[model samples]
Target chain A: MKKKVLLILLLLPLLSGCWDELYFKDLQIVTLVGIGGEKGDVTVHYSFPSVSGGNGVEYLTAKASGSSFSDARNNMNLKTGKVLDISQLQVLLLSDKSAEANIFDYLDSLYRTPRNRLSSHVALVKGELDAYMGNGKNENSGKTQDTPEFLTQLMDTIKEYSLSTDYNVQDMGSIMFAQGQDLALPLLKMSEESGQPELDGTALFNDFTYTGKSLDITESKMLNILQHNTGKFLRDTYIFEVQGREVPVTYEFIRSRKNWDIGETSITIRETIHVEIDEYSVTPVIGKGEFAELEKKLSAAIENDMQKTVESMQEAKSDAIGIGRRVRAFHHNLWEKGDWHDTFSELDIQVKVKVKVERTGILD
Target chain B: MKPVMAPVQMFLLLFLVQTGTFFINFPSLMIKAAGRDSWWLFFILGLLHFPHLWLFERFYRDFKWTKFISLLYGIYWFFAMVSITSYTVYTLNVYAFPKTPTVVVILLITLVLLSASTSKTSTSVNLGVLMLPLIGVFLIFLMMSINNLEWTNLFPVGHMTSKDLFRGFFAAQLPFGGMELYLLFRYLTAGKIGNAKLMIYSGIWLVFFMFMLILSLAFFSLKEFTMISEPIIYLLKSQEVTFAERLDLIFIYIWLAWSIISLCGIAFAIMRLMNIHRVKKPNYVAAFLCIPYIPLVWYTATKTGTELNGRILTYGHMVFAFILPLIVILFNRYKGRKEPAK
Candidate 1:
């Protein structure tokens, strides 16, 4: 009896292993998920890598519609043999039309689900998502292929260049729920020339609803710089008339800093950018005085463009730059007294820009 | 044989018991009560525990080891054991194994507790050594999360009213009831010193509590903190490393070691009360007493039961941890005056 008890005790550790453990091979790993359509009648798209004997890995897409996001996922699960696992999900795409109406209603499912990755990249899709998903050709090679790996690589390249904000689900959720702040997601559309998906600026959002306004690539880079989200690299081109010639000057951002001063009646935003001149179209022997002149013109031009962007954001009643959050942090009395959304629209604001050229790419 | 413990071992045991499972939901609860000023509320509550610990120490020294005092200590440990076991089981069921039956989880946890309880006090004290490295890893994780910290989230510090601060302090003080176990196990320690050791113990706990509160406030915005059920676990989840993903899983497993140590401490107190040392198979008696706790824990792990359990814990801590010890000290003083000196 003693030996029998010892044997059972010794075997208990092995029995303590997970009884309902799931294996990788038995799971249909969803890489990309897309949500579209109306609130009650929602459309969900799931894309996964399917393995076939001696045929290499094939990318498969499935669609399901139901009354809600979870119901839609459940409907999709009915069509697949394996369990749909979203732990490996890489990106979530939302259609522009549905996003403009109300994106939070679709995102509530992601926030509530414990298994969903909070860091999954979220983007806004322009045009019909069906057409974008159906395209099966590589833009550069003209090969018939539609895979998540390719899509992820494309967005990563865009992120590397600082054309779009690296807005993940957690970031979007934080901004949506947080007061005095809004969210911005990278926008993607099929390129007219290549018929492949490409980064199309950024989609601005007020609270949970998408504003019907977006910033172009230049404006987007400027906003990213002001928000201190200049990812790995940033490139900006300026066409300036240097000595009666339209000289195209390209600058590479090295670093930047933004400071805000909030007062009772007005706000001041100061941005200082340090850049290296990578390309200068003018072939003149530019001296120190000429370089200073070029620097002044560049700062003024950037200041004007940023001022216009801020005006547009204010016109849309979107505090995408988080000035309201700044006010709430420092100027509490103002935040408590007035409606920030309304205050943000008509509040006096100033923009100050200072540009410093660190190095001129092995040339004067 | 009576098991002996060093001062360091006693301190570590008390620290683990006081910090168990409470740190999981503390940030969320604190934020709900005090908003952005949760860190201040935590600081005040930590300071408040010093007097309570001092009073309890005084009571323990004056009373020595009486049957009546042991009975009260046993009741306190009994409630603590059930609460901690139920909380640990609930956490495991929700986060680690969603599909596992609650009964199986409870039984497994109880088995681990029994094994640790039947061992010598020195063996449990050696297990307490694991807490040193656990604290080291927790601090390292906190430092690594500095990239996500937003200093502005801690602004507007004096926004909460006195009433709100009082409520937050009371809510924060619920977990410190674990310190009451010190009264039961004071005999195991080598020295019968003054309140110096109590001060040191309270100091260590206060520093740890303040660190957790401040880090949580700095890492998450007020609105974001309120949305999360367990801010510490979520904070761990946000930390991404190149070598491993899901650091939260690793954190939960390590935290389980501390939970088990706390459970062992509580079970040991109960065993002492029942005079299990008199029996040949004391481990059997300890295991039997823990069986009825499993179903009780299961019942209290539900939503409504958890709320009711919190209310019971609040009032119970006030009575058994504070009021009872103060009354006993006063009664002993009165008796000393009436009986005169020898």
Candidate 2:
């Protein structure tokens, strides 16, 4: 009995909890963080939901500028009156100007801090970040939608359509450190009509720096498909010449089989995609001969677009499709000869796409 | 009276000891040494344990307790326990309890060691059975990273050179350090655990380690292995479930529990060694010996402490835990002391 009492006395102090236990009332849960500017001067913006003075939940955005990324974060903390905790951070945005330099410089704090969230969605902004993160006098003064949550959902939608990938903060670290593969992030621009951030294009990155090049929505979709980085659902729309008039045909991706053949100085990529026709402008009373002709035309069109996407990536000196990974794995001599980006730019690449329409959406 | 153990209890005890808290940084160390070939290199190195276990099983019956060997091992266990507990505190400070004082953390661990040391031997041995459910949860959490694995990261096999292979072997000392405890603790078991059962237990452990090795290799790039000191913890940190965002916070506690259980087992072994030496109040002596660990653990919480711990795990584990035991077993065999004690 005495020993039991002593043991209880010994362990009681440990149960009182440590000093780092964050209280809900004292912590300001920062959900979104945006970084912009160059090496010497850095700007950081923080957005979090605040419930103050008996008002309803409202998101407040705070901005600060300093000489470094950590300096800017510490400066932003002075404006928020409470302890800044990013354990629940959901979205991270980087301006194109900042991404033009090495993005790793801005992301070092997120990687080093143990409490920081690694699953936060990462994107690159095309214009000034203040416009998207909302200045005090901008069009976002009366908006009901949360900018960070809305941008996250918009990126998710783009991923489902096979126009972008799901690159989180942790995923970026692996890709950045990989010798053979580069990273591509979704590019966002403020919409002129609605004054909201929208997915404008895809930002191509060579090594850690933004390549100062981007792809439009159609080309981004083609690049995503070539990389086989599709999400749950992929949709593609193409203009077809039917009955001497240009008609639109849309296909939903079902499944695909991809093969990459690497040679000494050239690479061959072949893919067979099975898709279901989601929308066809013409009625489906066509015979097998017309269906085969439609498949051939669709295949040729997609193959041409895929070739263009590859050329654009090569021109930007970006190996986002991970072709260099295969070369490094199989062709050791080639990988050891020179820098992978330079070699990737000079390589001869070919794309052959075959499209098979599996279903016509419950139509004859 | 001498303490006794059942075969399954012995198995669990050995498992806890061999695994312990060392696995936190084992995968990262191997990856740093062997580059992308860490997964298979670890497999080959893990296979070497079979022969080591075979030798131990063959020569264990002839084992005799000498004052010199006992003193050497007692000192070794004390230092190793301190090193491992210090690492656990350091990792907790980095990942989970940053605000907790080093003395406070070490005090908590010391309390556990004190209680386990002073308790009945069966209590410490039975601690492993309680860990079954938590082990299941750990494996489940580990498998959650499967969706994020990039299979191509494991390519370009056999990329490391001979020097890298040597460095990898040295880096494996901590993970493969505890095998010699089998010979030390074999006498405690009431029933004989045959060679086949030992091999089967090690095989199960090998498979578990391989799963972690392969997952870590596929989850992070080769270059990332150099940056992360503990890839397993960082791997868990990157994972997110619906219920919790930071899985590392919870898993670190579980890891702490495992470390405490392993420490209890070592303390029990120390007590047994004391009993064989005809020391009075052996359990109390063992409990008293753990008092110094409070300060030692505090010292090891610093950056230089980790480097010092690494050196101990390398040269100390090689000489005391491995080579000396082999030499003793060979010497006993040469003297024809192969008969089992009645």
Candidate 3:
């Protein structure tokens, strides 16, 4: 009884004094980490909550010189007037050069720090990270286009094409560390025929450094569907083509059903893509063979696309679609005996696309 | 000495402690240590540790009269104290630099507040009561985080070798390693409790929590894993309650509570050691002893600290926690000695 009393007594003073408890209001929220890398130095930039009455954001830039990553972050606090806040940081972009050289050192610094949330989007840019980050005019005057806006935009753009799933931090780790495979990130390059830049497909990486291969828009869509994972993307797009028509029939991926068969040596994978066709037809030909012909042409086109992708992925020796990972999961022992990735590279891919044109919306 | 926790509590303890903190860097850290095929590495390492865990259990079983840790004092008290002190120091320090208020503030919090509180919980029942809140918060966080979890995350269901299975299991340990505190906790074993049952359930529960946390972590954000610092906390933050913008703030606070409670247990163990050694004013001695450790915590929180702490944790686990317990267990089992007192 005395011991219990003593124990409670012991905890009272300590528990009552909660020294580390800080509310949301107390913290200076940081929204992004913009890493601009040179030959020797790395500059980290983020927008914190500004004290100014009119504008809520306080932009801070910190540059640090270090032989290694930790030294740079240590030097970061010294450079910036405010403490480097990371809890709210939503995005980190690496310049093309630094990503190519190797991003492990810079990335290691973020991994070591606890203040930074791991859900922050990690990406590589075509040119410099700083060039795009804070320098741009604040497009949204009311709300600062800090880290969150860019992350949302990048993710939203990919959503339209039904791109990769969970482009967040944990997946990055799995890609980096998971067995028998390398991780890949979608790289968005800046292209402006207009004033604003748009995010493209993806950049591939072999564990640590960038592989310098960029998948164009369509290929990324193909990669997602082939992997049999769907996000906010519809796999099919179509343009109707009939015989004696000036333009040949064109169909984009709408939906797909795929199946796989594995033998002693090779695996035969087949994808049946359902394409959505959008066309205006005032006079419709009531021909039985015409629909069949459209199916064949569309199937052949999809097959051609699929074949090109498999060949490109094979040549690159990259498993962005995770076909190797899939084979490894289902056939563990057989996978171990063979160089699964090599096997994947040499896969006898059979694309059997079934393109169905829905005339429901067509004005035929 | 009797068993410290009931089967359920033991189970909760394992699940809570092991699973929380490791998510911050487990994937990347393990990758660097093992390789890109780290899931396989963990599978193998997990198998390796099973025997090690068994050996550890056997060691405590043989020396039934004394705790496994008490045996350490007999062999190398000086070295043991340094190891335990440094460990508690590193845990409070390194964790603080990244997650909480600041290194110095957490130091004062853990050392002055938490360690001081531990000085009172000398008995088994009292200690269990003290640890209950930690276990509770852990379960709460685990359940809440699991609520928003997506089943598809574990998908692309691929085959893993005995190698991948082993890596995943060993990787499970980072979240559930709290079972190791059993060495110090032997004093709390109640005679009526099912000992092996408690430990097994703890390990299993821990494994499940780890699998869920790791699966969600890996599934939702593969791209940001390396770039983002704390994956587990981020996982919690991803949850939308319509009330909180970020669940991590609450998550970190709860986690700090758990760590502080655990650290208090460890620090109290040190104070008790000082009392037995006939030291004058054990608290004063503990205070004086803690003076040198603060700088280390400060220095390490700064960046270079992570490497230093990592080497120490890896080596420390190997030398003291991993190898020491295994050798002791094997030796005792071979010698056919009576089991130790719980």
DockQ of each: 0.52, 0.75, 0.11
Residues A1-364, model 2: lDDT tens digits:
9989997898688688757787988888988889988887999888888765665666778888888878987887777788677788888899998999988988788899999989888889987786665433445555444666677688778766776766889999999998799998889888888777988888899999999998887788877787777888878888998778988888888888899988878889999989888887786725747688788888998899889888989999998888888888778887876999999888899999999988888875
Candidate 1 vs candidate 2, lDDT winner:
2
lDDT tens digits, residue span B1-342, model 2: 243887788879989988888787888888888877878888888887777777777777666667888898888888888888888889888988889787887887888788778888779889888788998999898888988787877878887789998988787666777776787777777776687887898798888788877888888988888778878889889987788878988988899999899988888888888877889987667667766878888988876797688777778878875778878777877887643564
lDDT of 1 at A57: 73
Residue range B1-342, candidate 3, lDDT tens digits:
434345445434434344433444565454333333454445545544445445444455553334445546333423323333344344454444333445445355545443554345444224335545755664566566553343333334343456655545444445434445555444444444344664465456435444544544444433454444445555665554556545666656666555544444445445545544565876676677556555544455544455455445544445556666666666767887655453
| Model 2 chain B worst lDDT run, 10 consecutive residues | B333-342
Q: How far in Å is the alpha carbon of B79 misplaced in model 2?
A: 0.7
Q: State the displacement of the C-alpha of residue A307, model 1, in Å, after optimal TM-score superposition.
A: 1.6
Top lDDT prediction, candidate number: 2
In model 2, how large is the Cα lDDT of residue A263?
Answer: 81
Q: Give lDDT for model 1.
A: 0.76
> Once model 1 is optimally superposed onto the true structure by TM-score, how far is the C-alpha of residue A341 displaced, in angstroms?
1.9
Give one digit per residue, the lDDT tens place, for model 3 in A1-364.
9968866875675566455555766555666565656546765555454555776554533445565555666776675655556766666667767777656667665655555566666666777555455445555564433434555576655655565434555446556654445556667665555223466666766556677876666666667777665565454443545555544343445567878776556666787777554442523422556666666776777677666766677666666766655556566655667665566666666555666665424433
Q: At residue B162, what lDDT does model 3 achieve?
A: 67
Ordered by TM-score, highest first, the candidates read: 2, 1, 3
lDDT, candidate 1, A94-145, per-residue tens: 9998887778788777876555677777888898776555336566776445
